[model samples]
Target: MADIISLGIDTGGTYTDAVIFSDARGVIAKAKSLTTRHDLSEGIAGAADAALAAAQIDSREIRLVSLSTTLATNALVEGQGQRVALVMIGFGEDDLARDGLGEAARAGPVIFLPGGHDVHGRETPLEMERLQVALPQLAQEVSAFAVAGYFAVRNPAHEQRVRDLILRDAGLPVTCSHELSSRLGGPRRALTTLLNARLVGMIGRLVGACEAYLSSRNIAAPLMVVRGDGALISASEARLRPIETILSGPAASLAGAQFLTGLDNAVVSDIGGTTTDVAILENGRPKLDPDGAMVGGHRTMVEAVAMRTFGLGGDSEVRVDLAGLIARIELGPRRVLPLSLIGHRFSDIVIPALEKQVGSVHAQRNEGLFAIRTGLPDSMAAGLSAQEASLYARITDQPQPLTQLLTTAPQKSALDRLAARGLAHISGITPSDALHVLGRQGQWNAAAARLGLDLAARQKGGNGKPIAADAEDLANRIVQRLTRQSSHAILEACLTDDGETGIDPAKSRAIARALDRQPGVVRFSLALDRPLIGLGASAPVYYPAIAEELAAPAVIPDHADVANAIGAVAGQIRETVTVFVTSPEEGIFLLNGSGETLRFVSETEALEAARARAIEHARALAARNGLAEPHIELMEDADAAEIEGKRKLVEARVRAVASGRPRVAN
Candidate 1:
């Protein structure tokens, strides 16, 4: 019999990884490539081709293809995505304030229309005139539209109507609240839908790129995407609801950590280019977050691993704080291209620019910064302000020093706006550069890293002195600061997992003293109960120190760097369907689920219908996910109260879950 090989691909912020795996032999080969943001397909193809070549296997031997990515997570963390307009039905301005929707909108246009549905899925006269007038102009201003109606979970009629209109008129990707989640909170659901809408174009491109590449290779295999919950779903499903993939990469890492280390109880921390994700594995499986996946401070209703994502990573922008007695270095919540990387790619431009800046008489504000076009098509530049457009036009494929690119303060702001919109990339001093300067990493130009650090070292501190004596000293300081921040991030995740909400790791004196190993009359000591399993290409370099600080044993598996890719192929196909039965009054039960609402006169009839529908939906979804005979599990939660010696049925939720191994191609 021929070996049944599976291809797993993971696209992270900095690198794209690919691994070839077989059930009998484990990982046969793995390869990595720098992620090409201009066109992700370049990175995907590079990694895939390298892996296939390394394995010396025919592409036709691959039976399954699974993918995972951190693009959605990184986009949220960095506040970068396609601009989208939100259409709210039957929601007032006050509703926007309820779920951080206004803040999440982030200067995006929002239109409130007078239409909605009641608790029982009854229409409240949807107003089409406002949407008709606003959509055309909004389409020019945004890449997609989100339509969320009040109580859309109960009745999606209004939201569906608006979605159809947007699709017909704007011909843009549309996300309706009901399509994403079955939750009841209108504002929160709207927020999820809006975020999903923002990600549709981005995620669609990613999946489309992978599919196109696969088709070109003639590697006929079923494609699956890892979900935020560490399960496999059809690529088509993921393209429509990308919000569910917010933690897809992290979740895959969690699965890979377990599969590689075989540790039942451990704290799994995966560091990537853009984020450090931490989660606890218990009973040989990752725990699910009941409150939903929270990324970049927004709690989404996407079911995912109980992972805490931090913005500290190798490519994190390094900033200095000179406001105190001693200057302190801080790593990022934003990722910047490492000077080493940009220097390697554009050495002529980068080295000369850095050398000039370091030799200057005075320290320049933008000495070590450069901006380059991200290589996305100009169509994404829609709705750019005049200043933003002008600055963007000046940026080209070649790297331009930010000092030369921005002549004035307004132009600097405009450049920033362009970067935020993903039209441009800013390269600066980062932990990766620090690694290069320290000689720990040698993949890029170390001279450029030294030059960038020299510029950073010249900055005045709070004590009115240079922060460091030399470039190496400053690079060490930056690396040490990253280590400290990473420790704090791990500690914070541990505290949150232990349900110690009152003690903030950043401010907790006890934790600080413990981490600092400060000796006093009252000595404080803390340690994690479980060992730490570190996964990432850079994990071996950074996690040992972090584990020591936490007083936990560190475990870095052999293939830790390619863990996400391994997990992508090792996951199982799983699908879930939920049905809700609500009683508006006695003797009338309304069932809601699977994007439809049905009324039944009797409670038994309503429950039976809901159960049957949920099972059917789950089975269908499982089949779509490439599962044949999935094991099905049914769970029901019914809320009832006893009043005046009578049993009252308030509501009931029925859920069906189907899961199995993905089918292999013949």
Candidate 2:
């Protein structure tokens, strides 16, 4: 409606990036800011202000703003969602475990009831009085409600009735499972609905804040969000289907990669401050995994660009193992030394202060000094008395002798994970902990990690053996072992997802073991020939070798560090709707919405309808995003089944330019 110059923003774990584009100006400007985990809006505003400055234009010149962020994904991973109640119209306790719903529903209470409908739309008798009794208590505790019933898509009456009751009593936002996922499988559907409800309030606030920021700056652009599948959607639609934006960051990287390489099909990898993400693109579009994927830690059935994430990044922790067979491993991408430690080492300030306070020059005896100067945690500092603190300081200054210290602290945790199959222990602490130790999330952690590594190298191993003769090598190994496990797990998961039947357990383990070794891009390239494209913040550091390994040119564009932001800005609005058409009689397949029945015939007419539907859906999404004169691209696939007749699935994509032309400056 307004002149449609659009601004796109992408907020990652460590940075917030913004890009402003005008058709008239081509590309206006872009800006970046450090992401503030505490209050995300601060980072958003910072990025916006920077972008405005870069464009050298008043905020009023901006028309529409689109944003994609990791805020919701972070909330879920950090276990920080609002309280929610699961209102199941028909489910038993056994249903949770059977459908794999129990895992994601760990946060909320799953309430089962007596009402449900059959596949043919007939209602199962329900106990209204019992349900009424449970409603009040649930209403008091929960900020939101998620309603799911067996076969709700076939007969939503039971779910609707429950929704009506919840609206009257709970006075909270509610998400019907049927609305979120049109597929069968009650438990999976319920999980999706519950997740949607949990994130609704948080996402709403984030969007509202962004909108207000733009309004305050007089940027009147229509807001849009990049979906997880690398397609764009209106802000309102994204809010409704926030799950689709779970991997929005990675999707943006792929989009940016495609734009950079101008190659439709290739493997794209982005290495960032904390992780490296690898994904594949087909036909210039990021591939989508049909089964929902995991983000942070929870699993959700949202369409996202398929990717593998590794925690190996710049800020990982370095450690040594002594209780075990004399090895050292880094504890984190999350933990690190602060730059202040380096500054401290170059001066007598930190060590002298430690010696003065503790009344000891002995590194071990200077525990208080170690805590204050090196930013070690109380628990860790307390592990060392004043004498140990002095020793720690000596090692922090020249840590080649403290390998013994690193080795001793983590043996029990590693053994428990390996010997007891309790990976829970090995899951390292987050970067947040390291930040807290340093008194700042970013700068301090970096300094501490560097300082800690230098000190750790001086220690002995479990066998009373010296660590690697090379401190750098030892430091690198420790970091790799700690951060690479997640990468190992994700790659294994992808292999399993490739529809391999009855995978040999030994082969799976072998593959994981190889990946754990952190093969360079060359090794990975030999294994898989797909071209590798790097996208995350870490990409610059890792892509050259990765490109070499893949034996294909790797493209890292000007905005490579903020590839996701570019993707978020560059994507076109799109949507997808899947409808299954079938007939019980088995000869002809009838589409429910259109009442069009196709007899046993050639592929032409069936193909046309399927493509048309896909186009129609895509066009509608374009329209919603203010795209005028939308164009549709259709794709159709049909399968023959023994149980049901010929089934056709249609996928459509639509695109259009916004109605308003870009404004001319000067």
Candidate 3:
């Protein structure tokens, strides 16, 4: 059987990790490389090559390959993705107001057509003529399209029709709401579909890159992708519904934590470049969020581990809060290219720029900031506006000081938009740079970090004094702020799990007093109920301070850095399908599932049909996901009421799940 070795890969915001593992021998070898945002294939191939070389294994010996990534999660948190247009069928402007769809849609164009369906799976008059007139123009304005119709879950005919039109005419990727979730909330479903449409191009490219690299290496293995719930799915399935991968990396980390530590109950916190993901482990399993996975304040309908993702990480942008006298330091919600990294790549420009800023009498607002081209193809920049295109043109492959690039305040906004679209990257001081300055880390150019910090330290506080006396002092302040924010993020996740209401650890005075250990008339202290399992490449550098703040012990496993990669291959293939049977009228049952609706005169017949359809769909999905034979489980939730001593059926939901080990080559 050639030992049935499996290869796992995780492409995170800052790094790509690869691991070779076997069921009998465990992890054989692992390697990491800096993630290449411009072209992810470079990072993936680098990591894979290193891991294979370390293991001394031939590429042909690998039986299976699996992957997990934080790209979708990072994009959502940073509000970065391809520009997409939303097609709303039979939805009013008011519909966009619901579920924050208006905010999520951003400046993307929206086309509302007079076509949809009712709850009874009856179609309203569809205006295909109106759609025909608008789609041609809309296609030129965005990279992809999202089709969400009223009551799409009950009947997806309208959504499907629109999708077919967009795909056939414009040849652009289209996401239909019903294809994502069967839930009834039209606006929220539309929002999810819209987000999914935006991610298709990105995830598709990632998969294509992996497949291409594997093919070139002659590693003929079925490529699988880790889902948000730590299950494996075929790459093709992942491409169609990339939104399901929002927490893919975090979920894999949770599984990895449990496998590495053998802990049944603990709070697992995994820190990456752009986000820190926190989740609770109970009974050797992660808890699933019933309300759906909420990331970046958007409640998505994707099934995933109950994880709280905070935009605090090593590569987080270091911002100074000059509103207060002390000029408090705050770590990111937005990731920037670290100065240390930029210095390593372009030291000639970075070091000189920082030295000039530090030598100046007064530090400017954009003193230590720089921008560079992301190296994405010009095709990805197709939908840029005039201002965005102009700003993007000014940014070259070489780093340019933001101070030199932006002439006016409005130009700054234009540059930000360019960065948000993944067309450009802004380089600034980050915690990773702080670590370099303090001699805690030396992976990159420390001289550049020190220079950047010197400029940062010269900034005036509210008291009209320097924020810090020296570069080292500023570095310490930044590290301390990161620890504090990390503690708050962990506390908030715990409090939310404990069902605490209206109490945000970040803003709570009582929690602050406890964390700061401030003595008063009445002393207060807070501690986690369970131990903290910190997983990341920099966990050892930052987690001890975070653990101290929370009064909890921190456990860092030996393989924590590559946990996501390890977990990617240690997962099973799982597929779920939910079918709904609703009583639309007296003695009439309507069954809806898998984009099909059927009517039955008897309730018994409809329920049976729903269950059969759910099971068939689940098994098919499992098969498509590379599972040869799956074990099936069926669950039913029936809602009925007794009215006038007679049983009346409201709704019945039948759910079927198929799960099995991923098929591997012999």
Would you give me the overall lDDT of model 2? 0.56
> What's the lDDT for residue 147 in model 1?
86
In candidate 3, what are the lDDT values of residues 366-470, reduced to their tens digit? Answer: 878999998887877867889888888889999988778888889889888888888899999999999998899998999988888888888888999989999
lDDT of 1 at 110: 89
As a TM-score, model 3 comes out at 0.98
lDDT of 3 at 623: 89
> Candidate 2 regions off by >4 Å?
1-4, 22-28, 74-80, 126-128, 273-275, 294-299, 309-323, 328-446, 452-461, 464-474, 478-527, 545-554, 578-666
Q: What do the candidate models score in CA lDDT, each in turn?
A: 0.90, 0.56, 0.90
Clash list (residue pairs), candidate 1: none
Per-residue error for 575 in candidate 2, Å, reads 2.8
RMSD of 2: 9.8
Q: Relative to the unseen true structure, what is the Cα RMSD of model 1? A: 1.3
Query: How many clashes does each candidate structure show, in the order listed?
Result: 0, 69, 0
Model 3 lDDT at residue 416? 84
User: What C-alpha lDDT, on a 0 to 100 scale, does residue 52 get in candidate 3?
Assistant: 98
Model 1: weakest 10-residue lDDT segment is 500-509
